[model samples]
Target chain A: MPYTAEISRTNPGCFIFLVDQSASMSDPIGSGEMVQQRAQVVSDAINRLLTELSVKCAKEEGVRDYFHVAVIGYGHTQVGSAFTGGLAGRDLVPLSEIANNPARLESRTKKVPDGAGGLVETTVQFPVWMDPVTNGGTPMTRALGYADSLVARWVDEHPGGFPPIVLNLTDGESTDGDPTSAAIGLASHATADGAVLLFNLHVSGASGTPVTFPDGEGDLPDTYSRLLFHMSSVLPSHMRSYAASQGHRVSDATRGFVYNADITSIIEFLDIGTRATELR
Target chain B: MGAHSTHLDVQWFLVPKTGSSSEECEDAIDVLLSPETSSLFAAVSDGASESLLAGAWARQLVHGAVALMSAADEESVVGQDGLSRFVVEDLLARTVDQWDGYLAKYEAERIARGRPITWYEQPGLDKGAFATLMAVHMREAPADPENPKAVRRWIWRAFALGDSCLFHLRDGRLLTSFPITDGHGFGITPQLLGSRNRNASLIADRVSTATGELRTEDELLLATDALAAWLLSHPEVDSGGAGRQLGRLADLDQELFAEWVQNERDKSRMRNDDVALVRMRVKTEG
Candidate 1:
């Protein structure tokens, strides 16, 4: 019942995204035959997160401000707001504003099944809120601390609402120090509903296979992946139930951590209302 | 199957989620009285809040179900001996086509108002709307000749999908709970009817039907998911009666109903979702 707070305009939820902008992120990561820059992967995830949230609460008037969001990036010696365009320098912007003030909208192509044996190419308008930036050291400790500030203030403003969820997109490397304690500090912030939730998405360079929401770190292959996994919050009951129903083999110990896999699936963890069983 | 029967009292109560406005409420209900057939037909649908135009789809679904059932030349559209699977599936297949017409007009009106659809909303619209439906049809059974004075019965049939429930009550006790019997069954993303779905067999497999007999002393309650869950889990009902709260359900007007719903939500007795309730009691007086 802890995360079962009614998220609405009167009592909204909050999201704080922590992006690792270390120089190593510019390096390409190859999984099978496909290659993608870690920075580009994280950037795409953030933009999709915004889109998923906006579409969830959208109505006839427009996207409802059922949530407040803040994106913070850490690189070199700085940790600050990652928003671009009109929303630059701003922290904790409402969802409606985020929906209206994206940096730009880019047309992207994707392949879809055409009800035949083959796939067809289709174009979709993709909104961008941040560009890939690979600057200096991965100050992940500082990044967690930065999210702590936003989460602390948000819980103060909406004490009775659902707790803030901090999603950290990183390569599981820390330049400042081990980020375990800093992650704990960030998750300590609490509202009447529950404590802050810190979910980690590790974009590893060395990957045999992409792991999603693993309950244990046994198959993680490296220490950095294990460290980030240890710092993540367990999946809430509602999200866990959804995962189990989807045949994901989830349990009470399942954390909101994804290793090398697309973390955008976590956006579906949000409990807005009854959604379609299948997208089609 | 008909001997000029009618529902004596028909009342419906609705309230949006605690923080939402009236327009934001997505649950829909419609009751049609067909004098020609001496039948009472009703339908209630709970729209998935995450889908665009869900409320409109729910409205269209309920309205379509009742209209189609009543207009059918078949003696009984859906009953114990009725082909409920065919009737319900065909109704869904047709409603989706009607939704296309609704969308066309809606789009034109938006353009006329100087505001057009946005990119983000298009995915949800294209995916089509989804909602849970509970539809009922009732008629007086022609005086069971062998048991002529068998409490002057009425036969009712209901088609259901998702967590919405139809409760049959007599002597202030529940006799039946359809589709979902417990509170834990809610919030499970029950199989929803999509706006573009035309697969008859797919619809038939997901739909459920129940038939019951109503006496002069019997009453019925049709409720959407949230309220239905609360009723199933309510300790008051477990204490041997639904008398205090449910007995007076038909007596409540919109204002009183709203107050009761708000109180339940404040006490954390019910989930904070849009609620719709329809009450039907037999007319005892000749």
Candidate 2:
């Protein structure tokens, strides 16, 4: 019954993203063609996730505040809000404010099918809320702790609403200390619907194949991914079915962790709106 | 083709999502019944909540379907076997063709209201508003045209493209359900009719058509996804199920229907979505 609460404008859900801004994030992320700095990758991931969420909840009037969101950056000495532009210094803001207050919109071009078996070039406005910043050490422990405070406050405020979802985007390098206890503490926050959900995304320069939402850490090549995986919560059933529908192999044991792969699809898993269920 | 003594009592109940207003409800219904005639045209559409102008498009679909059905040949009402592909294909094509004009008027209204299209709403608008449609054309006819002693019966031809369903009941027990078989069959991504879709063949392929006859006291219910899913999930058992609820709920007014839907939503027995239901029963006057 937990995680079954209706996410609506009146009883909104929460999303707290923890982004790693450590010096190690300055290094390149992937092995193949599309390589980017870990900081940029995580920043883009967060932005893309936000964009998708906004679009998913958009209506004729405007984007409804079905979720309140926060972006926290952790590096060097301090862990704080990462939003830029009009929303700078804000912790948890309504989604409509985030949608309207992006730092700037960049014109990006992409190829699309032209309906005649050919491709057409189109320019789209990409909104950016945070820029890549790489500083000193990876203080992931503090990042999770930061999210814990926000989740605790959110659950207290909306005890009958859907529990907050905390997603940690890191490089698996925690300089301050072991972040396991902090991760556990963050995931323990609860609302009347269910306990807070903690999902992890590891974007690192480490040499390995990227895995997403694995049922176990058995195939992980190193300790970093294994640690991140173990810290993650089991995929909620509503999201599990959606992810499975999207061609991802998942089961009851699937954890909400991704290693060097796109977790933006997870945004699609959130049920902010409805159509009908099409035949499988 | 002539007016008959047979009469059908029709009623509809509508409820928006728990926190939303009636104006914000995406479900739509349009019915056309001429005075002193037994023939009726009805359409119900459930708009995709994620799409822009979905409610308007849903309203447009129902109105258009009923209007078009009014002009179509009465004898073309399909039987238990095959459906006229042209009729369904034409219905969708005509609706899609008119969407551009609707969009133009909507744009003007939005600009006048100072809420011009924003970046986030662009994608959903470009993809077009999508909704599930179920429509029916019903009329009274002789039970057996060749048999002089046969009584009259009501015949209905219906087409469904998504989770919105049609139910036939006899003596308060469900005899059949269309488009969606059971409650578990409903999901978030129902087959949608896009406002900009022009593929007649594709639309016809996905559409499911059913024809049935109702006796003097039999009932027919056409409902949007939320109520339809809940109704279909509860099987027609001899002791309880849809039978008990049907008898009690058939006469509920707007306020009571809203309360019933909210009660079910509170208990988590039904998903929190907008609900629309059309209830009809056949009657004969002496």
Q: How far is A95's C-alpha from truth in model 2 (Å)? A: 1.1
Count of steric clashes across candidates, in order: 0, 5
Give the 10-residue window scoring lowest on summed lDDT in candidate 1 chain B: B1-10
lDDT for position B62 in model 2:
92
The ten-residue window of minimal lDDT in model 2 chain A covers A271-280
Docking class of 1: acceptable
Give the Cα-based TM-score of candidate 2 against the true structure: 0.91
Every model's DockQ, to 2 decimals? 0.42, 0.57
Instruction: Check candidate 1 and list the clashing pairs.
Output: none
lDDT of 2 by residue, B83-141 (tens): 45677666865688889888888888989999988889888888999999988888877
- Would you give the TM-score of chain B in model 2? 0.91
